[model samples]
Target: MIRCTGVRHRRLTIPSLAANARQIAVIGPNGAGKTTFLGLCAGMEEPNKGEVTLFGRKPSEVRIGWVGEFPDRTMLFSRVYDEIASSLRFRHVSCRESDTRVHETAALLGIEGLLPKATDELSGGEKALVAFAAALVHDPEVLILDEVDSHLDEEAGRRVADAIKSRPGVSVIACTQNMDTAAEADLLLYIEEGCIRHAGTAEEVFEHLKETCFYPAVWRVRGC
Candidate 1:
């Protein structure tokens, strides 16, 4: 769980947390600062003015597992198994435990077969699974996934959804524009111009969204 007080960016200002959610989905047109807000929640970036905390620790002080829109940044090693194991190693988990943890996470994600392949050898979807595996290997308390669903196809997308629901001990905060994706979230935040303009449960957000002024359908379906 996270709470932000006195957050400011450019002309945007939020005196207190307008939204609090265990599973949050942020949506808005591009440049709305959805990514920026996610970064702040994940402690990947700092708020120029306020305090943000994860389980009571400062944003930067808390340890979190993150997967970005781009899966390429997930690697520093050549092999998939090593890449997944790096988080454990960095946290000083014993070598034996690291291997065990990596195997467990990969198996759960159904990507254990890719363990032997080189990082560059995996397809985009395959690499995405690897990135998620790496993040889960440590089992951090919070997981920040930035538009990860955008990289997946239908079947793979379902698998990602199942993975999120099955995983335990982590609060997920995903930034996405997919209504299907938002439906799976416990909460939804509409970020406009670097601040939260509206927030509610998925049903509430969608209902409000249908009644309010916003732009460019999230998915652009020919007929919805």
Candidate 2:
């Protein structure tokens, strides 16, 4: 579970929130504090006030996997295999276990073939896949994504969505502009001007946004 109480950082604010859903999607307009909320959840930045916790512990104390809007900016190793193994190596996992986990994670994301490739040589979509493999290799308990699909094409996006579905035990908090994708989450947070204007299941929250462009296009076509 993720909880926030009187959380405030920069322009973002959350008086109180407790989310136990497996997948939580944060949707809002540009500069609406979506990324800021994600950053707080990922423990990338400290809240100026109040607290944020994951599973009864401070967010920084939990094992978290994070992927950002620009995966390239976070890439460290030149080779894809090395990048995926980086986290395991940092935790001092044995060589044999690290190798096994990296291979397993790559296979899970259908990126085993890219393991031997160079990160720089891969295309944008391929790089995103590699980045995802790196993040998932260590089997983090919480996964935070900041508009990761924005840099991906349709097929890559589908692959990512499938990969996320494969990890039902992990808590996923994603900030995305894709309403279709947001609609698939277990819980939705609609924010504007740094405040969460609505929070609920897709149907409940979309009821408040049916007249807005933020309504899922698929729902519109279905006359929902």
TM-scores, all candidates, are 0.89, 0.96
Query: Could you give candidate 2's per-residue lDDT for residues 81-146 as a string of tens digits?
Result: 999999999999999999999998888777899998889999888888888888888888998998
Candidate 2 lDDT score relative to the true structure: 0.89
Over all chains combined, what TM-score does candidate 1 have? 0.89
Best candidate according to lDDT: 2
Clashing residue pairs found in predicted model 1: none
Q: What are the per-residue Cα lDDT tens digits for candidate 1 across 126-186? A: 8888998888888777889899888888887877777777875678888876776776678
Question: Which sections of candidate 1 miss by over 4 Å?
Answer: 10-12, 211-224
Error of 2 at 176 (Å): 1.2
Enumerate clash totals for all models, in the order shown.
0, 0
